[model samples]
Target: MDKEVIGPGACVLRGFVDDPAEMVRAIADIAASAPFRHLSTPSGAPMRIAMTNCGRVGWVNVRSGYGYAEVDPLTGHSWPSMPAIFTRLATHAAAEAGFADYTPDVCLINRYTVGSSLHMHKDRNGFLKDMPVVSVSLGLPATFRFGGQGNGEPPRSIPLVNGDVVVWGGPSRMNYHGVLPLEAGVHPLTGNTRFNLTFRAGVVKPAPRLGSKTG
Candidate 1:
């Protein structure tokens, strides 16, 4: 556990797990199943980032609105299962950040290119806000905005690179956080886009089988 406490309830772990390359491979396999798509917000503006997911559940938003879904709305199939490697990394990172027995059921895969950014927001789809979200960054580099727990507070920007893991929970669970627009670059392993895998405990319902159903 390469741990560094970056804030009151935020932390960064460099090379948090062994075999970072293998982790990227596993993520690729997962993405192959669901493929990546530029999702839309409730207001209709397309998200700056392209995304896909792997795990028991995938976070999605469509004409119906934002929520956890069993299938990828685009492929009409279930997203890939959360690989063991991902589960292990999440658990390890969580334990290092002082939360033990953390098993994440949802793995949100976000892809960012130059000028792609995520607005400050909170993760509220899960049951427990106190469980902490473990985010792993790979390929390229980006600035992460860390704001106070309140929505209106000004946020601090932190730079992140490949193999960097950030965890936020407890009082910081409600902290408003996001990624600033990424700069264009080539990461040997991931190329022009920044790959991020965020682990969270999703809802309990069973996810549909990929290639087996369509909405």
Candidate 2:
């Protein structure tokens, strides 16, 4: 895998995952149990992307606020376990980006279709901000903005295609970032949708075994 650095402690690894089809099946099995839903923001506005999660903790935007929880609020059950492939891929990517011993306990899976997007923002939710975030991209391509720590700085737009993984930490962990509106098109793997799996290093909560069924 070729590691390309874009900023301080932020880099991209090309074609990091050897088999995306297997990962897709794994993700489908997970979504079959937990399912994916459009989440509302803290202010009651619905987000553009549909999401679900697998791992010790899942990121959620609930009626109360945005946070992580051991259970999925929608179904009253625990999130699926972080697939071994996911953990292995994330750890390898982080290590290639200079972070070792990355024990990711939260893997948030976000799905985006045409017109889906996100505004620039800093990630302040992960428990271990000191650790790097390992993000895996699959399916459709999208433009990613890597910005400065402050809001006023202009962001650099980078095209991210399938099988690309990014690692961000250190001085760049708090840097502003977001995705541009997705273009209307279909990728062979996922049709018109894009998938982003972000892994954050949080304390483990003993995730359920892989392929466990939930209502």
Using TM-score, give the best candidate's number: 2
lDDT of 2 by residue, 139-168 (tens): 999999889988577899989899999899
TM-score of 1: 0.89
Alpha-carbon local distance difference test for all models: 0.80, 0.84
Candidate 2: stretches off by over 4 Å:
203-215
TM-score of each: 0.89, 0.91
Best candidate (score: lDDT):
2
Clashing pairs in 1: 55-82, 78-210
- Measured over all alpha carbons after superposition, the RMSD of each candidate to the real structure, in angstroms, is 3.5, 4.5
